[model samples]
Target chain A: MTMKIDCPFAAKILTVFIKEELAKFGFKKGVLGLSGGLDSTVCAFLAARALGPKNVLGLIMPYGTSFGEDVRDAIGAARLLKIRHKTIDVAPMVDAYFKKYPTENRVLRGNKIARERMSILYDFSGREKALILGTSNKTELLIGYGTIHGDLASAINPMGDLYKTQVRQMARYLEVPAKIQKKLPTAGLWTGQTDEGEIGMTYAELDEILFHLVDERESKEELLARGFPRAKIEKIMSKIKSSEFKRQLPPIAKISSRTIGHDFLYPYDWEK
Target chain B: MKIALAQISPHLGNIQRNFELHLQAIEKARREKAGLLVFPELSLTGYLLKDLVETAALDPDKSPMFKEFKALSRDISLVLGFVEEKSQEKGLFYNSAAFLDKGKVLHIHRKVFLPTSGMFDEGRFFAPGRNFRTFSTPHGKMGLLICRDFLHYAAGYLLFAGGSEIIIVASAAPGRGLAGKNGFATSRMWELMGEAISRFSSAFVIYCNRAGLEDGIVFAGGSFIFNPFGKRLVQAPYFKNDFLVQEVDPAEIRRARKNWPFKRDDKPEVILEALKRIVHDYED
Candidate 1:
């Protein structure tokens, strides 16, 4: 299945979306964490175009286990856009906390690193008087591959709706650094940690199944008939089901008639 | 006569702010010497009003806000969308569009189709309108269809049967489906419908869609005008606030109607009879 999008059209619309949405909330500047991965690099390109290079800031937050090449690529992306950037080694803060509470689990340590980066991003956001722009694409968001309150937290996200494969298309159109585009997708949480490696499928296969399942609303049986592996379908479906909570606000128990997440419904852009 | 489509963003659930936007647009249209100014669906209250419908609902005849608009209409005719509160019942409301001309409410069209599926929950909030009718304007006989009402072919057909020469649609359609190189898939669908309706009905079709984002739903602001012969007169830019004013000669309506003669050959009695049979069969 060819899940192609008009790259130029998407780029124009996303740029406008970022600019207008930020202005709606009285923000003229934005700051986003740059992982040197395709997602953040694409976001950096869009943010630069939307808010101008001087107004946008990219933060490269990496732990001790992070690759030196990834850090360099992050700086390269920022320089390519001519935007201001800062590299903060998250090892000191993350290590300081884990020193008292030592754990052999890499996932736990990675989650801590993600949260530490978010904390630093917020600090920079306040210091620079800028809103934090999110970089999670539709694939990561749908499959629950992100850490909530960590990478998932941002005032606005222009690339969240675009799937991973679509982001690649956008990157090519935006002329993002070829090295970043060609590099294997990773969270850069620990050494040699790749997204597709952990997910156990290439982005092409995952996005095709996800597009059918989510966007086109194709059933599992229909996907099977269309030559999709049933096991992959089941695995993706289960992941989606399990990660549903990550997509929404915490359920507020209805103790009153007008609950925050229930009856008392207000839009996010509601200035009043 | 010149018709102005105000493709603007309405502040969500903020009547005062949106009303200010309307006044500004009205001033601009008047300065441009437009005979009529049309705003998008819920121009006073914005779309995605889940629980704020009642808060924004107003009785057109009783509200002080309309009085101001009515006074403004004395200078230029206006068409605007708002949640209409039924005077008799306190809670019953309709997604309605009003035509104000010469300081009076000429016609109010409560939206007949309340789309309540897949990212839309209009039926959950408001009552559906029952009739599709046309009202006389100084320029021509015009009909109003709000957003989803324009989607159903029957609404335009009914208005066409009612001797409408101009079909005005106020929409807050969300932008989606980015596979096409031209623009949004949703905007393309609206244009296709507008072309078909204008050609078959032999009436001018003016589509006014809102712009800007509300809770991530971007209202595709590709507002446009189709002449009586299905030729596009003008179109606004997508996803941006724009004011489009075009001079539409009333003579064009007559020429197109005479050339096509679709209305002269139309038979509504046949359609009414067929609808009755279809309804009976479906109920059975």
Candidate 2:
């Protein structure tokens, strides 16, 4: 089953929300890693809309194993958004560390590539004076599907609240390139690697279950009664409960009266 | 009804920028699970826009800015101040407050008692509103009073008579007088009135005011929410922009009214006939 969203309504709020949040922090320009995937495409379009096309810069940092069509689609998205974009092949940077200290595990190598791409993106942020906009959707963030300090490291993320399915819906509303929107979801970690093939379930199924469990706060029995299979329910619940650490700030042992992340909470624009 | 009061500074004559500010506040409120959000007077356009009124006048149903607002109201209700253009008439506008919910305009209150004295020259730019009535919302019956109108006790009386259980005040009041230990004199006075109204009418009061400088006038930022018993549930900081989300129970209205019996003993028809006879028989 497919999901539905009030596209125009959601788009208006999100664009303005992004624009105002950035302005409150005194930022006029934005930079982000755009991989031509649905998540990054949606983020790029929203960033362009918020800061204007000229103020937004898209950085396409592709690994050596990244599909050629994916890189082409990233270029197409940049043209469509009319934002200044650059293609920086991260193959050399990622390969440098791996060649010096070889790793046999495919997942370890993939994590290295992801973190290297993030490192390069940060360098550009300092050089260009732009905030790094994150592209990880709620689905990936909840399940720890992406590298921790890699794709998840962002100054601000407009897509953090949206589930993967909603990201696709937003892409359609933003009139993203049809080819990119229609393509299979991927992390581009390996050749022909798809997101659905990786996480062992479709985003539609995962998000629907999560919507009920997280948003609705449904009990396990209630979810099973709602026709969610027990195995799938247990699997998703385990993932949600296990990845709690990744989603949270590094916990500080209670030694002081008020610690940084514990009691001393303030808005991000506290000084402003 | 869970409510959020957004004490924001709006750019003068820049409806697009101001509209985005309103959206940002609304979206934040919705995330905090607030059912209703309120903004200060002329939130989409800052106050003291004497000549720029024509450019800022929005036909509630026509303006693209308002269209976006309606779309947002599908999930949460909002109260905001804007220049309302009468559809049938040109060049006639009112300093209006709107109650928007579920993609529809639930009610609108045109500021009736336009303050023309002292620093307030609202009557110079806006036509006076004639009637005060309460309208129904998804939460309950509600009324709207903008800025100076909230000060007039008669406004609350009329709203209570019209069955309003929640009174929303949206203001762009300038912060004035010596600062009290807690807040400004203007804000303290408003809080006193809010408490009095809550106890007298047995209704909740949601007050929203703007922050930041508009021209030379510094709009006060002491936005607050009071329960039916006049207890200050939440308050934003003074002289700076702030947003607060607080939970309010609609059930409290019934409990407070049951204890007070004010609405039950109220006489709307007698007051109406007496006022009518006074106007007809007496010379002012």
Candidate 3:
């Protein structure tokens, strides 16, 4: 039940959305953390097409335990897109932070690594006068698979509405390298950390069911009647329901008659 | 029934320049051998006109540009959005759309809903219109809506009740909510509207939306056409100036209506009585 995404239409609007959104903030250039994954590669292609390769800056940050193949793929993506890119090793920073707060907690280490990469991307954003473009897809954002204030942090995100399956289609349409497109999806937070292994669901299955549940607004019984796995439907539905807060601006205390994020919620680009 | 949607980025307060753009688009559509061509709301005067609306109004009857449009319609029928200057009364205007063919205005629809809340200030710029009528065209019996009018269900219902075989909406919608790589959430919302009316009423639907940035607000320009079965026949590119030409079959409408006699079995008098009763009891 994989959805057939309209690739040409999606590509056109996304490229325009990226370029126009950037211009609204007076940014002619953009920055992104290229993980050599399908999502990042697709985003890099769109950004390059929108703002031209010279205006896009790709940062490839690999941890000490990251596979060398991932590094090669990231560099390959940058070269193919012909964007200004730099590879910065996050090993020293991740190691230094772990030394002070040593722990075997996988979640904490992953969070730290994500935040460190985010911090570096933001630094480059300021130095380069470029906005930070994001690579989080709809599935990851809906399920809270991304770390908050880490890789999820961005000035503007163009791919957030697309499902993982849709992302792959767009990547192939953008002509991303075969290595990046065929590679197993991973956050590279730790060695051998695959996204499907962590989420315990294939994107095609998740997207199909979610398309019905979210897009078609099908009820639980309706989904089960449609032949979706009961347990998988429950898992995906609960993840989306609980991660709602992450998709919104932080709640504000309503002491005044008008609150920035509440009563007086203005658009983010209102400043521009 | 070949229809063409010319999605152009109109310069604010420049009706002359926009008219020239329309001429170019009309020529392109003519070259494509299209039967009908449509443009977005205020395609002549760009959106967000607070102080410029007064100077932007064009008299559809007297304006020589409309004669040009009428002459062009001899080759290809045209639906265009412009600020219509109220002829009988000076200093009054309406956000209007004109249907032109064979050297005359076939119909003119002023926007019924003047959106005032949020970023829209149409109420401050022009007066709201009152009628929703369907008129004959070279292609089919067509109804016209200007932007916000299509957002209301009654607009479509009234047009359908008047025997509109096709509904054309000219919109100047700004893009918002970039939830994912899919572009504007605005697009999905509009698609839902177009799909429902096309299927339920067994009528063709043409939604022409503008593109490009307007004073920091980017117009999500995904102009598209849907057949009576709610199938998207053609789609224009979003966020850029573009056009699409597709041959529509009025027979699809006839087939859909014959299959589902919803239009045939409709009870318009009941709706009128209900609305009258509601209006009588309304306190607000």
List runs of model 2 lying over 4 Å from the truth. Answer: A1-3, B1-166, B169-284
Give the range of the ten consecutive residues with the poorest summed lDDT in model 2 chain B. Answer: B176-185
DockQ of each: 0.58, 0.01, 0.05
Clashes of each: 0, 0, 6
What ordering of candidates by lDDT runs from best to worst? 1, 3, 2
For all predicted structures, in order, the TM-scores are 0.97, 0.56, 0.66
iRMS, candidate 3, in Å: value is 8.5
Candidate 1 lDDT by residue in tens digits, A1-272? 34788888788878888887888878899999998889999999999999999999999887874477888999998998999999888999988999999998999988998899999999998998899999999999999999988999898989888999999999999999899889999887778889999998999999999999999999999999999998899999999999999889999899986789777876777743
Best by lDDT: 1
TM-score of 2: 0.56
Q: Each candidate: fraction of true contacts kept?
A: 0.55, 0.00, 0.04
Q: After superposing candidate 1, which stretches have Cα over 4 Å from the reference?
A: none
Model 3 per-residue lDDT tens digits across residues B213-238: 65557798889998988888888876
Which candidate number would show the highest DockQ if scored against the true structure? Answer: 1
lDDT of 3 by residue, A182-201 (tens): 88899888888899998898
